[model samples]
Target: MSASLQKQNIVSNFRQISSNKLILAVSCYLVLILNYPFLAKTFSAIVNSADYNVLFLISVPVLFICVFNIIQSMIAIGGFLKPVLIAMVVISSIIAYATLNYGTVFDFAMVQNVVESDSAEAFSYVNLTAIVFILMFGVVPALFIALAKIKKQSILTACINRSKVIGLCIIIVGLIGFSYFANYASVGRNNRDLVHYITPFKLFDASYKYATRHFFSPPREFLELDSTPFLKSSNGNPRVTVVLLGETARAQNFSLNGYEKDTNRFTKDLEIVSFLNISSCGTATAVSVPCMFSRLSKSEYDKQIANSQQNALDVAHLAGVDVLWIDNNNGSCKGVCNRISHIEISPDSQSKYCDGEYCLDEILLTELDKKLKNITHKDTLIVMHMMGSHGPTYYRRYPTNKRIFEPDCPRSDIQNCTNEELVNSYDNTISYTDFVVSQVISRLLQLDESTGSQSTMLYVSDHGESLGEKGVYLHGLPYAFAPAEQTHVPLLFWQDPENSSFSLDCLQNQAQLIASHDNFFDTLLGVLSVQSKLYQKHNDLIAKCKGDSRIAFKQGYGIQTNEETK
Candidate 1:
């Protein structure tokens, strides 16, 4: 044969091979692009660390790929594989980028954060870099798949192919299970966060769990409380108390709590008691806010029970204390303010401070005098929910003019910023919170002078934030594995000169005492002088603050105590 004829034959053979294996090639490429970063990280950790054996290093990837292929094959059965695969690719890309950027794990709690976030909060994460990266790696492949002409197979052939894939996956998983069960257990015990890095599967698993827990779950029944005690003048003046619920404000950043930074410049000089050791019930608003107002202790608390039971606000309202809840934060009061006179400062409301997205914490104090004047009751309990230091957009929480810390991180995606910049930005938010709290106290003091009313204010954060400490950021980790940054929150107490219910000297002395959100309900009840049957005197921080409370699950499972603060 001639050399030219032989070359032509070889070229034809190569073209035939490519045509025959086009779908398989595309699938393999899709899997590689989608899972490359995750696989690289997993393998790199296994290689660098002596903890994992060679077998695990090999089997983990193999099993993961097998399972992935099985999922793809199954999804392919209904001719919907392209769309599903595209969605998975995009989702996985976003998750992978986030994991890499923030050094976070995609667990149930993280999924819950995503689920609970509003559209604006969600959109803040959409950065140019992440979008470009996704477009290059994820969207391009998805576009290719979308544009490709997939060959329609017979129903029987498709079923057979799916069955074969499933059978292969089962066999591979079974082999892994039988051969390395002990190794798997040991690795899982040591490296639980590793499972969260398994690309598309982790995203799917988290979504399923969130949907099951949030959407498919049965509605919790509301628990009603008995009639509350009617408030009468204990002294010569009417009782007016303001409870300031702060968000994402950690104790570690407060100068009053011995932090080096001047974050609490406004409140540091005020006659306020700052608790040095204070833990939150949960690391998220959905849990902590509701739990803080519940009668049950953290250990005894049940989400169902807590949600159903009448909260501290309910008791105060029934007790004839004019209860009003003013919120600058977007989060709900978790039904704690349901029956009371509640008003949210709409982001859309005309205000010099508001930008139609989020108003400053100071906006909650907008109509302070008017709100106070309209209340016809002698004793009033006002709850002000401030949008204090909520992140990963710490800069947005405070006004630009309030940026005391220089060179603050202006971006919402905190991970992209340097640690120092992130802290500076976060500290500015805390400083602004200090300013807001001081303004609130000043308002109360002014009210006291004008109306001869005795006033007091209590400021406590819903949860603390993690500013890139130990590879964690923006809080909301499960309480068991969360660091102090996510759990240790700030608690401040202030009262007017005329108010003498609790001695400041004694309260200041008690500031060093350990406390948690479990004390909030009873303490506030005591402050309002509401003698309710549900109020536990032992849990009241002001009445008798002595016991070490355990931070437990809402399901009554004891986890740890204030000792974990160390």
Candidate 2:
């Protein structure tokens, strides 16, 4: 073979490669054109992160599209490359939706393992995430690729029968995916049109030039607090109130609520009120806890935090509560400093005992014991926030050895775990929290008995937890959409029995009657002896149920109450 012969072979190979590249590029444009509805909404969110982790996780959807595209290509060879291009678009859309909404990067392999080992019931809800994946990454894209096949290729114009058939198949399937996307992206009645945005090409621009736009940035404002009279106790000394904030302690699981679980041994008689129909402001602690403490209702917590920004602690202090906060949470968000006294339980170097991954609420009790000594005056309010049933890593929230209710029948993962196991873990946390809170109540009672001073205890959780209802786990969903699990938390009050003012009958009635988290602001005002200037008289649980409040559930949606809306 001479030099010319070798050069000719190389030139032929280059032409073949170039032709394939052109075919693939053209296919991508076709899919994008066919599926414009889903792409537009998700684009900004996908590109915002401009991250490597996001791109890598996107492979799942990519593979889903690839499988569908290959099938279409095999059946209709005319536009074989179209399937691949469409797959790319769907994958990018996933990254766009998940990223835009501030979804965490999931460890798919670990999650899969958890689901596999656990009994089917154990991880039932967790598998919903998997379903979420298949839909976003699989079903919809495949539909497009399949439907794209509808447009028949011109047999007369085509030379290679195989290539032409594949190309046409690609078009038909791609169109199918688009039709589904149209209904899905629209957020309609049944489908609810959960749409995702972002195309592969846009994601590929890691330099983030596509994300760049000439937009105005909003100026951040400092949070403003309201002045009130919620500081002084019934006795009206210096006024110190300790609000123990529990996480995910649902009333259903408590023995106090008549559940078989002996979890609430601590709250046996001291007077507990079940805020029967009360709902959470949000699901995630990051969202709900801060939102609950915010002056805004669940309907407007996010909006209020976004624009106006006033927190419970901030207002309590301004009202002269001598607001002192000690948190056992993972971190701070509401910025409960500036105005009140702040003590971070997780970070305090002086904290001798608890360590690693959110403390088992007991630590707050111990810290409060030490801190209360300094509150020699009457009006000192202490807020203790606990890390309750935060999901996926429930075991991490509490010590494994302390897990009393085994075989736990413990499933390996979120999807695998049974409702019972999930509830058990949740109950165990509640049990531990009850023990700690009861200790505070008992001690306060003892202090009152010993010193001839008045003392009382109030306990409320930020929000409730979902076991596996409607294929959802944990909490922190948007308030309008959140389930009963996210909204209904436990509220109980324990007072010194010696005090005639601690009416047990009224307390029991309030527990069985209708109430809202909104009452937290006002009822505390009544208990603490200071009349809240901001208090609304309607929903105040103590005030409404003074004799026997019959209203069982606040019937409305998105935080609008009969009391407030009118």
Candidate 3:
């Protein structure tokens, strides 16, 4: 043969690959290339110089390779191999970018956030780094896979080969487990989140579970907690409770909660009282927001159950209080305000507080002013959802004037920025949030003075944020493994005493009590004085300090507990 012909023949032979070989090559590529973050984390978290530890480390990659190839053998068949692998490459690249840059885990909650986030919020994550990473790792590899020459196989031959691959993998896995069962169990028990760090597998598993629960399940029956809930207010002086629903504000960063930085300078001197120790239900808004509104406790909270029930807002609306939700955040109220009167402030809304991509939390105050001018009910509940400190665009959350912390991060690729810069930007958002909360208190006080009415301000963040702590930049780890920065949140309350019976001193005393999102529903009911069969007295933080028996009721007064119903 001629030299050029021989070279061409070699190239062609190298490019041609059978189905099983293709699956094996792709699985190895996934473990070694696309799953760099997972491997890096494993080495950092579990590797040591011990003999068994070294053996366990070596077996990790081998085990993953066998298992992944087995999965590919089942799914990536004759005509489907290229397309399926291309899709995996593309999606895994994106997931890998998030995991590498932000230490994100593609858990069920994170998947829900991605699936439900608005276009503006989603686009905030787009940047030069993401583009380069996806292009190099995702699109380029996908093109190679798509263009590869995959040899054909008959149905029977394919099935036999696939079964062989599966059997071999299972046997290999069993041998590894049997030989090192003690080490595996010890490591797994010690580092419970290690398995969740495995890329693509964990990501695919979570996506499938989310899809099945949200799309494949039968529609749950919507249950109303109370049909005849009544507002038991003092002499109807148009009681107004402005529930300032904050976003991404952690208690650890607040000066009111003992942080050295004066992040709460705007509201620190006001009549607001900060709850020193407050935990959120979940580490992400998609979970915590709906859970906060539901009557379910954190231990019992389920997304389907929360979505298919009458939340605190429903019972309050049914009790004759005019409820309005003004959302300035990028997302909706997660069905919390679906049954009530709600207004969504567009990010593109032509307002001074908006910059065409994300409106400042002050936009919520603009809507609040408009809602206050036209009060239609003697008792009202206004939920102002503030876009407070949502990141990696924390710099965009507040304006230039509100940049109280100097030398702040100004870019979206937050991992590249210094920790000091990131914290400064985040603290500025909190400072701006403090100003907004102070303004809400000011407006409520004005309403009380101008109309001889009673008004209160309740500010609670949906979930806390992670400011590059232990390499974790954003929220949404599994709740069992989430850090304090992602779970501990701030809760502030301010009430006008002239026209209302609730005392600020009592609230200040109660502020020291440890609480969680479980208190939110019953507390809202207590603040609005809404009498309902769904009211759980122990969960009502406000009623504990009301100093009245009517505000106090025994637990499980008007309804069956969730356990009983089950």
Candidate 4:
């Protein structure tokens, strides 16, 4: 009797263990909603953007899945994945919307990876793998059916569950200590050093010199305030010169010059001078932007740093002229804003966590009239550099309503999507940029009515983007091999309609004349009528305006004013 009783007890315990295993499996399966780590980051980012519609849409499915999964687990049920599949499809639309509305770093990552590998086929294969993964996701439901028959009595729990635990452990260890492979076994104390870990090819930057320079660079005090006004000169009184130093703007997609789309509709009315031959010195902001302001060029940037003096801003300030910088970029790239009074147009609002997708490009223009009127001195120079066409997430670069094309990263990986979709997302951004520039110029033209002064708005992008053309998307490759698409950019200057010097007839001639950034220093000095020892008329736009004295030095692949336009 005792032996029989023990046998019964053993059988009962085995049954209970199996029953419990079934319950836990069902419960954990519900947790599968949390399993796809990528979805959380993507959804969270959209919910926390400038607009709030997406956040609301995601809540419903999220609620349904949570409740249904929990109840199904308690009931020891299965077959709820159909609804989950539907949920992903719905969520993808919103994700697609978010992606289209802003710029992402995926393309940059792809290109940087390709360059590091020196492999065109690597990118192509990486793209192929993403498409295969997406297809695999669609068939995952059928594959899970075998789980219904598997014995759950073992310690492994489930293969997927074990994998998650292992992945988390690896992530923690990686974050805590820089592995041996890390170029520097040190993480930064402040401002998290994710860029070092990223940035293609594992090459490390010691100081985050590029990023920090935007926020923490020792200020060069490049420009200053002027105390006086200018009297009438040869062409009446001096006019306002608005120099727009575009941030991360690529010219290959700019419509006014040669893009296939109508990206420059807003600027259509003003004088349009198209220069297809312009280019930038470097890709990284610190290396190129500050260098552009400094006396340094591409080859001389790093080496000339200490010896360099008298930047473009300082020269403008010393000439007894009012110089103001209206910025919509990341905080003057870190104190690059010190000397000039700046307006922060980059979003400070984090109402939505993923607000980086869309830009507040309109923010800088709001103060245009007030800033212009506030300039107490004559020969005032205003520099506005917008956050233009910068992206890996091209879809996130503009607003949803601005979307002019379809099938864009309607899916996540660009390679997984179509080329037309990529171009469409990019073209939309260009359209918005065109409108912003045009609106700014239109407003400037209207100002002459009240101030009784002449003004000119000059817009030039810092650099260009690749947009999957030549297998590149973003800028900042090693300058040695940066394609023409990355280096060649757009340059435009519109004289005050009322100014006597203003004439549309001169635009074609003005644009055709090759001009390099080398002339930027002297050209700006001449335009503002600033008199200084720092200023040399040896080669200036004004001298060219007086006669044809401008000289565009064709330095290698870059354009020039003359010199054998070779």
Candidate 1 lDDT, tens digit per residue, 1-566? 99999999777665443211343444455456656656766676667665668988788767766667666766654556667767777777777677666655667767766766677777777778778888887788778667665555677876676676578778988999899788767666665666666776776788898788668989877767767465544755777898999999999999988889898888876677898899999888877888898887778865567767788888888888888888877746756677788987878879988888888888887756677776577888888988898887788988878999988899877877888899999999999999988988888888888888888899999999888886677877667777899899999877764434455555766788898998899889888888788878887777742122112211122223344657
Q: List candidate 4 stretches off by more than 4 Å.
A: 1-238, 303-308, 349-358, 405-407, 410-413, 502-507, 536-542, 546-566
lDDT of 4: 0.52
Ten residues in sequence with the least summed lDDT for candidate 2: 548-557
Order of quality (TM-score)? 3, 1, 2, 4
User: What overall lDDT, based on C-alpha atoms, would model 3 receive against the true structure?
Assistant: 0.85
User: What is the C-alpha lDDT profile of model 4 across 73-190, one tens digit per residue?
Assistant: 3333224333433343333322232222222222232233323332222232233444444344333532443333433434455445444544554454354334322221221222
Q: Model 1, residue 148: what's the lDDT?
A: 62
Question: How far off is residue 229 in model 2, in Å?
Answer: 4.4
Q: Against the true structure, what is each candidate's TM-score?
A: 0.87, 0.63, 0.92, 0.56
Name the TM-score of candidate 1.
Answer: 0.87
TM-score of 4: 0.56
Candidate 2 residue 476 C-alpha distance from true site, Å: 2.9
TM-score of 3: 0.92
lDDT, residue 251, candidate 1: 93
Best by lDDT: 3
lDDT of 3 at 462: 92
Candidate 3 per-residue C-alpha lDDT over 139-211 given as tens digits, one digit per residue, 9 for 90 to 100? 9988888877866678898789888888999999999989888877777777778778786879889999999
Compute the lDDT for candidate 1: 0.76
Any residue pairs clashing in model 1, and if so which? 223-308
> Model 1, residue 45: what's the lDDT?
64
